[model samples]
Target: MHPRSLRHRMEKAAKLLVIIQKHTPEVDCLFAPEKGEQGHVVCEFSGSGMSRSNILQLGKDLEARGYQFTRKANPWLGQLSYTGKADEKPTIILSLPVVKDRVAINEDTPATPYSFKEA
Candidate 1:
C-alpha cells in the first residue's frame, strides 16, 4: 500500500472500534439506518448467572442509557425451531434514526416494509 494510504487505514482501524464501544457497551448499543441502508446486528448476552429480575432490570437500564430495543420475535409466518422445539430465546433489536437534530422513530408503514431472512 502507498504510505499515505497505509497511514489512513491504520488511523481508521484504531478509531473504528473505539467509536463502536463508545456507542455500544455490553448492555446495549444504538444506531440508525439511513436512506437505502440495510443490515442487522446480533447481540449475545450472558444470562446464565443473573436472576430473572436482574436481567429485566439490565434491559431497562440500557434503555435509560438511550438504547432502542425490541424483543426478537418469531417471523410472521412461523417460528424457528431448534431440534424439535421452537427456539424461544429472547433477543433485542436496536435501531437509531434521527429527525432534524433529535432522535426520531424508525417506524415502518404500509408502503415500506422491513423483513429479515436467516439461513
Candidate 2:
C-alpha cells in the first residue's frame, strides 16, 4: 500500500477509537477495510449483556456525535455516516442481534416485510 494511504488509515483509526471509547464502550467494534469513498466499522453487542434499548441508545449517541444514520435492510442493523473535512468519511455498520426468547412470536404475529438473509 502507498505510504499516504496507510497514514490516512491510521489517522482515521485513531479518531474512531476515541469516539468508540467515549460513545460506545459497551459494544465491540471491528474495523473493516475501506471501500470506495468510505471506511467501515462493524459493531456487534454481546448477546446476554445487551438490550434493545441499549442498541437504540447507541444509535442516538452516534447521532449526537454528528453522524447521520440510515437503516439497513435488516431491522437490527443500520449504517451511520459522518462527513467532515476528511477525504473519506467513516461509515459505521452496527448489527445488534435479537435476544433469543425475549420476544414470543406466534402464528398470529404478522411476518416482517424484510427477508432475513445472511450476508
Candidate 3:
C-alpha cells in the first residue's frame, strides 16, 4: 500500500480511538498504529476496581457494532478487530492488566542463605 494510504488509515484509527475514549472513562491510555503496520489502537485500562468490567463491556459493545473480536490472554484480557476491509479499518486492542493485591512481607524475616558463596 502507498505511504499516504497507511497514514490515512492510522489517522482514522486514531480518530476512532478518540471517539471511543469519550465514552470510556476507565481508559488509561490510547496508542495509535505505528508506520507500515495495519491500523491498530490500544485502549489501556487501569485494571483496578471497575476497570476490568468496563473494558470487557467495551469489547462487547464493539462486537455488537459489527466488529469481529477475540479475547486476549494474560495482561490484556480484551481485543477487537473490524470485520470490514482490513486495509480500510482498524483493530482495537484492549489492555486490562490483572491487578493483584499487594501484600506486605514481614520485615523481620531473615534472607535465605545462598547455595554458593560470593566474594
Give the winner by lDDT. Answer: 2
lDDT of candidate 3 over 3-108, digit per residue (tens): 8976787677776666566558655644445633556676665543444445445555555555555442331222222222234467665555553323422222
In terms of TM-score, which candidate is strongest? 2
lDDT of 1 by residue, 5-116 (tens): 5454445334332433444445343222221112122223332233334434544544443444433222331222111101221123432221232222243223222222
The lDDT for every candidate, in the order shown, is: 0.31, 0.52, 0.50
Task: For model 3, state the Cα shift of residue 65 in Å.
Answer: 3.0
Give the candidate order by descending TM-score: 2, 3, 1
Ten-residue region with minimum lDDT total, candidate 3 = 110-119
Cα deviation in Å at residue 86, candidate 3? 6.2
RMSD of each: 15.9, 8.7, 14.4
TM-scores for candidates 1 onward, in order: 0.27, 0.57, 0.52
In angstroms, give how far residue 81 of model 1 lies from its true place. Answer: 14
RMSD of 1: 15.9
Q: Give per-residue CA lDDT, model 2, range 39-71, as digits (tens).
A: 566676644366656556556555555565544
Off by over 4 Å in 1: 1-47, 75-119
